[model samples]
Target: MKSLRLYGKQDLRYEEADNPVIENTDDVIVKVKAVGICGSDISRYKKLGPYVEGMVFGHEFAGEVTEVGSGVEGIRPGDRVAACPTFYCGECESCKKGELSRCEKLTVIGARHPGAYAEYVKLPAENILPLPDNVDYDTAAMVEPSSVVAHGFYRTSIKPGAEVAIMGCGSIGLLAVQWAKIFGAKKVYAIDIDDAKLEVAKEVGADVLINSMEKPAHEQIMDHTNGSGVDLAVESAGSPITSAQVFALPKKGGEVVFMGIPYADINIERFYFEKIVRSELTVLGSWNAISSPFPGKEWTSSVHYMSTGQINVKPMISHRLQLSEGPETFDNLINRKGSYVKVLFYPELD
Candidate 1:
């Protein structure tokens, strides 16, 4: 099988590898159909990795089941599925409380375990979410990322008529714009450095678009909110600058959700730190979505939205590359030389 394996920091190779087989009784071997490149994947490629050398690394993927282990039930061979990347020990207290993301024993695919950056990948059947026939592989692969946005919204306390400012226009940020509308946000501000991404944000549902590079994102958001800042501020850009902006873009006593993972030390100035203390703002940090009641409500909701055409992912996908183009594709995304969003990699050539 052909796979993209991590060699080291700034090194990813498209090479040959042995096909994965079912190792555990509940394991399922999937012939990977499509996989989406995530921001974390980019970080790993750039040497910001705890990634293992020679390990396959893609968590957002969908495929057809080719083999199923004996202990697995309900799911059979040939089932179209999108599997959750985060797996938890069902016996943990957190898992018992339906907080699968907080399970004491958590193993994430593409990080702690083998991932889907190949022709085939193996995972426990419990992680699989059976996809409807109407959902294509490209969209199915998107379920993982879309679920992240869904989970972010679930953690916030935004009311139906609340105003929202999503501080980024990346894939997750753009998705957050739509989720804000779906959740009945009356006004949404999509903030980014790129106008192209802001345009997409508007097409999705942003009532206001601000290029943070051209002017102050917080100033624009505050202006729209009549000097009171947005009711809800979601930080999805994961940069120090954006993180600082989100802290100052929420109304006093408003809610702020930190959905982005910062790669560097984020220094909050004394003014902003004092503001957080004085304003009584609720700050939340949301990690990967969980599998509550099995397979996660976020994943299920994303599937429902996608299947019903309520949340369309067609426009977000800007590039599709063959598996062999892994090296160049990573470079293109890293350099930001192309108009790209949600790049998908197809392992099998039709």
Candidate 2:
């Protein structure tokens, strides 16, 4: 199998690896189809995270089932599926309470376990989700990421006619823009320094676009909302600056949710910090896409919406390359040499 392996910081290699086989009674093997690069993948590649040396290097993917263990019923070969790569320790306190995402030993494939960036990958039957005929492999490859955004939205108390401000226009932010609409936001604002990304956000249903580079994002959001701010604000840039600035985008008593992982120390300014204290904001930090019954409704809803043409990822896909391009692609992505929103790699591509 041809796969990409992370050797160390900024070191990703495209090479041949052994094929994955069913190792447990409930195990299943999927032929690699479409795999997408994630922001966290970039971050982890730049700075090593919890991973096995030279492990297969991706998680967000969809593929055809090639084989299934005897115990794997209901799913069989030739099935098209999107997989939940998340793993939770079933006995952890959080899992015991039906909060699978919060399991003390929560981790995911492409980390300690081998991942989907290969000719074949294996997983337990429960992690496999069958895709409807309406959802193509490219779109199904995005289910994991879409579910991530849905999980964050599900944590909010957004009501119909509420206003929403998404403080980023990256893939996650673009998804947040659409999820805001799904959650019934009367108006949704997309904020970012890049006009290109903001345009994509507009294409995906954001009602307003704010180039935070022109002015502080919060200020522009306030101007649009009659200086009252929005009912809910989402920080999805994973940027140290936006992590703090997001506090000021919501009105007093409004909600703020942090979905992006700002990998550095965040120093909140007095102005932004005071919004949380003075406004009595309800702030939350949402993690990976799992919940109670394992992969949970986030995955189901994401697949459902994608099947219905609601959660569109077409605009978010900026590049589609073969697995062999992994090394150079990672460099170009971090070096800012090209327009990158979401980059998907097809393992079977020639």
Q: Count the backbone clashes (under 3 Å) in each candidate.
A: 0, 0
User: Which 10-residue span in candidate 2 carries the lowest summed lDDT?
Assistant: 46-55
* Candidate 1 residue lDDT tens string, 104-191: 9877787778788899998887788899888889989989888888888998888899999899888899889888988889999999
- Candidate 1 clash figure, as a count: 0
* Residue pairs in collision within model 1: none
The model with the greatest lDDT is: 2
Alpha-carbon RMSD to native, per candidate: 1.7, 0.8
lDDT of 2 at 225: 79
Candidate 2 residue lDDT tens string, 87-132: 8989978899999988899888899889988888898999999999
lDDT of 2 at 207: 94
Q: If scored against the real structure, what TM-score would every candidate get?
A: 0.95, 0.99
**Candidate 2 clash figure, as a count:** 0
Worst 10 residues of 1 by lDDT: 46-55
Against the reference, the lDDT scores of all candidates come to 0.85, 0.92
Candidate 2: pairs in clash:
none
